[model samples]
Target: MTGAPSPGLGCVGAPRLLAGLDRMPRLDRTAHLGVHGQLPQLGPDELIALAEDIELRGRGGAGFPFARKLRAVSRSARARDGSTAVVVNGSEGEPSCLKDTALLLHAPHLVLDGALLSAAALGAEDVVVAVTRTDVEQSVREAVAERGPAGRRVRVVRLPERFVTGEGTALVSGLNGGAALPSGQKVRTSERGLNGVPTLLSNTETFAQLAVAARLGAAQYRTAGLASEPGTVLLTVAGSTVVETPTGTSLAYVLDLCGTEPGQGVLVGGFHGRWLDPASARASEVSRKSLAAFDAVLGAGAVLPLPQDTCPAGEVARVTRWMAKESAGQCGPCVRGLPALADVLEDAVRGGGAAALDAVRTRMAVVRGRGACSHPDGTSSFVASALAAFPEEFRDHALGSGCGRRVLGALPLPEDENPERLVVDWTLCKGHGLCVDILPDVVRLDADGYPAEASMPVPGRLRPKALRAVRRCPALALRIRE
Candidate 1:
């Protein structure tokens, strides 16, 4: 079967955003006369009960229980202080995922309500919504304006679109007026978030669910979904061929969606996520625990179906290369390790010897859990999962020749319009050739004597050397693409 049609509000075809619109309970006009009726204020105990009843897990890829996170913040007496804060992370940096943007755009009230309710429950006086500088910001801004007074108290902050900039810590840094990057030190936002206060930060959809939970008591919220994981989830579906089967397509498309048959494969949870064969995933349910049963979860709600006619191995190689580049370059292991893993994956795709596959396995083991952040771990997961899920494709490429098809960019990038590319301005070239000496894999000296071969795969291991080369180049001809 083919993939389902693209829904509205970032969902492929169905109106996922409008699912609970009419179902939302009417607000008490007397209590909220001056306040926007969009938000339904939830009590603390009710919120906890609702979360436990629905078993709502964090939508920020980690799949941690919402109740657990709440307890963590609530356990601390410091949470009672007005210094505590609630942050709505609308910065959907994962290129393959558009569910957050959908929530913010078409269902801003739901997201805002969740944030406001979370603040009230956590005893936080301030709530901030952090969004990318792109289209998401405009939608949230309009939502804030429509709410009038209630929205005024909720601050909306715009952020750069860097891939890592959307990480929880990075978002906190941005709100604190620092550069949009992860900190070198180990710090939890709950301990010190905006203005050095306890913060409850979560994905936009998580907050939307929170709002829903607050409105419907825990018992009612638990009515839907499995006992381990109650409630619906938002997913951005993509693939070479759209699968019409929809086991996890949300309420809007659940009736129309059908699940893919056996033998098919899909990329779940975006770039940092994993790949699974439909055959192996036949029994896989859409819940967090169900996916985890298969060593996978509905990460950040992204599901991409791969086409049978397309080269899965080639696709993996292409994405692996991009993943290597997305690293923040803060940690040495991530900066250097991901590129090495990507190269090995690429070699395997290009019909390289068994050594390539062996090298990938070895390097993957070394890179996993070594980064200051989760970048290296995520990259390793994507690679390792692809290898496990698509053994046939890997074997084919290894035994035979190339996959034959050109690398089609099925996966999205931080800047799909303009992918990162190396550039060298020859006008400034004094032929110092320090770049050539430093990054032989990326740059080489040509017949003209000046360094040429500007375009090359940037290996993670060579990033420091490459950066050194760029810095040492007196002429400043070499520049890394953003």
Candidate 2:
């Protein structure tokens, strides 16, 4: 299933997950064999020890200790008297992210090597790689086919392409034929996942690094990056180009790689990530530990640079609106509070007074940690960081007119195939109070007694009510669409 790997534009330093990607050859079975040779067969205890020795943490956003996750699943399997399962998550759900897909597309064999190696170590019979895009699926599938019987053991599940569908538990749910949404309750995927069996689920980059660490051993693996966070990390630079740079690489250097200088600020960790001013961003490094000082994490390897020419307040407003639309609509706070936050930001951008800023603060407080998932919390962090990071620009928008710069769209929000955005056909509308009355949480009326806007792409919780309102609309003005 492997195509020719893309020749990367060479690493600023050492490359691991993106090793030799500059050659631009997909590490197919033969090429993979030529480069890394055969995967070393390691017993479960040995692999876990090696991970511990190298302090290999999950490359996923949380940066959970890899050794701990392996031990948890292994111990759980032993207790249940049944084998565990492994899931290599490649569902790059965030619009500003593509590192997982890039890793698989260029080096599918490496991901497979890690997954297979992990399966043997964990005594798991089933291994699944969940991906959202078709290209990634094809690349990994071809690589699997090349492995023949060895590849047959690895299953590639194409998941729904939604922002939250890539959540660990949600990926597990989808793999088991359930809807691709995070569970309403807080449950670890390692404890009860994949048909109620303990599952070892890690990001694609984590597994790829697992293979690299197993091959290099602990001492060699620690050769690059800081002692605390060793090895290279694959990053999707600016939502477009992909690079594998050493951990702790300067954000300035990352901007250089992306061919853009630091502007007003830079967004680390994608839409759900935080914003840092130019100076703080340049001082910060790519590692999770380093980013923690800025109250940020290296979430999903997304690093976007915000241009100064663009109106920062307007850009933040647009992204906040998008994040609000992406909500699963599973929780009350996330469903209602996000749009409120976006509205305040937009109002500030449009020259609303200090009241808008107060509303933003209040709504941000209301949405924190009150969701079934982290959407509310993450979205809150995003908006709050925008305010804190660019106080001057935000204040200008709030107090005076805007910054006079148009929104340059420095932040990219890729279009979704199934948008599910809420819309109103104003041409067909007579004054309709049904929508406003039925879905009070979302729909509101304008001065002319017409439905204004319900924050298009109504949250999932209100969609049913929205649909009911749409159906009952005498003028048929309201509709939900992609």
Candidate 3:
């Protein structure tokens, strides 16, 4: 049987994944081939009107209304220069998220149309698409290279693939050639981004949706999804179990939208997202506030179903460990607290003592809002949600038995891009043996009283101790597998 028809007029297939997308009218291919007629450009008021008509919310995780973001940037636009910059944030740093890359690869022009239209609407002078050093960047770069005069002012910026690097502020910081980390100083990218210029920055999918809305108008755009949401949403569906469903599934998978069949559970938004029973999900709408009411949001466009065979607690623990490692190590809370939380989670999964669960909760509370960015907050949300959603799993594990299966690492983790283990600067080492003392399971001292055996699993039981070791190390010679 043929797959479901694509959603919306411009593109179709799975809202997020672009499998079988080759037959569709790809915006990227059209622009790259110098097909200017197909590219739609809207003036500021027209673009604003289009945005208002569709009632398009930001497609990024936050789900801020597009019109609000536009207004914020427009208000910041200087009267003297009448100039603003549009930033297309394609940095898909969330390990489990692939929606941004899918759009960049399959429909580059859609995003460009949105950005260019928004820029014109705001009287902005420049458009910059920020992507990570991945295949997505190469595709976007080629698309940019192919644009004739229309793409002249548009540029593609390649960024590091760190977790925090994709945050709006971090992306702006990286574009300025600074370290790719969010600043503690409260500042809006719209008020100041890419060299202190007034800017309009949004996720790539947001721009593509804007482009579609501009062409189709609000009434046409509202035909597909719920009245409250008013448009189809792209969702990256990843799970162990696969289900065969009809094509053209409506965008609003609201609680009322989903049929009677019980869903296992869903990770709405991305890693920094929350969990809800698939059954409970049926009652939830796809609107920003609706999802928020359920303690969830339509984040960076990822909605993953958890298979029954896989243990949710085990999965949460694995992702927590990965999140711990992804810390940029700039702040004490993230640098120290995440590993501690991860350790507790790993212990809980291993069926450790009640102390382990208590430790995890304590560390999560300590780490929340303590990072230079939202990394800790996101990590804490994932863990806390899992604990709340799967009380039975936590109770079973607290008995100090086991979850019975090995962690499958269903949630993606950034692999060690640097293949080597921790390199100790021996000269910096004063033989304090704090590393060994804190993480005795992983780090042990040699007969000479020097640190050795650094390649063992850091135990969850010793997280607090390990953090003390990390803090007390005078030489700072000890490092995790980078």
TM-score of each model, in listed order: 0.76, 0.85, 0.77
Stretches of candidate 2 off by over 4 Å are: 1-10, 416-482
Per-residue lDDT of model 2, residues 48-105, tens digit only: 9988988887877878998899989988888897779899988877767777877888
lDDT (10s digit) by residue, model 3, range 373-415: 7888888988899898888888687676655544444555554
**What is the C-alpha local distance difference test score of each model?**
0.68, 0.80, 0.68
Better of 1 and 2 by TM-score: 2
Model 3's TM-score against the true structure: 0.77
Query: Least accurate stretch of 10 residues (summed lDDT) in model 3?
Result: 1-10
Candidate 1 residue runs with Cα over 4 Å from true position? 1-17, 20-39, 77-82, 184-186, 239-263, 414-482
Best-to-worst order by lDDT is 2, 3, 1
Residue-pair clashes per candidate, as listed? 22, 16, 11
